[model samples]
Target: MKTLLRTLLIPALALITLGAIYFLSAFLGMIIPVGPEKEEYPKEVEIFVHTNGLHADFVLPTTHEVHDWKDVLEGKHFGEFETPYLSIGWGEKNFYLNTPTMADLTAPTLVKALFLPSTSAMHVDYMYGKPREGDHASSIWISEQMYLELVDYILGTFELEDGKAILIDHDGYYDYDQFYRAKGKYHAFWTCNNWTNRGLKKIGLRNSLWTPMDWGVFYYLEK
Candidate 1:
């Protein structure tokens, strides 16, 4: 019995230590400003970052000066309702398809996400109404150039086939939404929230140094 206890103790302590270090580093990364200083834009464009407890999405206008989102997303996927904003999110394909809600989440899905190189998908949600003030959303005002750069960064995430997004044939939880095959592989380190953080960094926006969770991404945005 003593031998068995000793065998279990070391691995248990090691896991606890690793967990502590990961959370500590994530907290530090959330607070630290690692990118370029926030700059003022003459011509402001309203973009938003929204969080639903665990996941994060980057919301952009449907029609910008440089890019017509409809040109890529199309009206067919969005249904009859005309939406003003498009909310985009990325995640592991198996987890996304299998676990639409918290109730559907399984241990196997989570274990696969953490241990394996999983296929990725992008969730596109069309919003008719704007994000209200004091919502679970952070609004950022950026220049036209910055907006263009941000759009380009988002477009690059899509795995294009013949200059078009490869739409995944799956019904999303919401009405005005769909999923598409994304470029990157989803893993323990490179999560959905991390993707949002990288997108903000790409456009030279104020963002966390390294965020693997939704709250971590929202912390600096709220500040």
Candidate 2:
């Protein structure tokens, strides 16, 4: 019994230590600016970053002067209602499909997500109006050129076929939203928040050094 206890103790302590290190790193990364200071552009376009306590989504106006999302995402998927904005997010396929709410989450789903190179999907939520302040959302003003470049970066993250998004047939929990196949594998290190961070970095926004949680993305924005 003592021998068995000794064997179990080492692995248990190792896991606890690792957990502490991960959380510490995430906290410090949020407070520290990893990249250069955010740049300001002469011309500004409003974009939103939203969080649902756990995940982050980028919200952009549907029709920008440079690119109209309707050119790609049609009104049909959004119940034929021409929304003014779209909220987009990316996550593990299994988590996205199986766990629309916290109640739907399970240990197996989390285990597979953290341990395996899982498939990914993108979530699209159409909105009739712009996101308001105090909506747990942060708004950034970027130049039209930067916004256009960010648009290209975003669309590129979708796994497209013949210049079209690969639609995933699963129904979203909300009526105004849908899912599509996405590029990259979702794992413990490279998470949905990390994807958002990278997207912000691509557009020369202030972002965390390394973050796996939603708060990390918002921390820099709030500051």
Give the clashing residue pairs of candidate 1, or none: none
lDDT of 2 by residue, 37-151 (tens): 7554665689999988888989999887888877776436545667889999999999998898999999999989987989999988988887776647998888888898888
Q: Model 1, 15-100: lDDT tens per residue?
A: 88987888898888888876666565666788889887778999889887777887787436555767888889999999888888
Off by over 4 Å in 2: 36-38
Candidate 1 RMSD computed on C-alpha atoms after optimal superposition onto the true structure: 1.7
Each model's TM-score?
A: 0.92, 0.92
lDDT of the candidates, in the order given: 0.84, 0.85
For residue 3, what is the lDDT in candidate 2? 98
The TM-score of predicted model 1 comes to 0.92
Each candidate's clash count: 0, 0
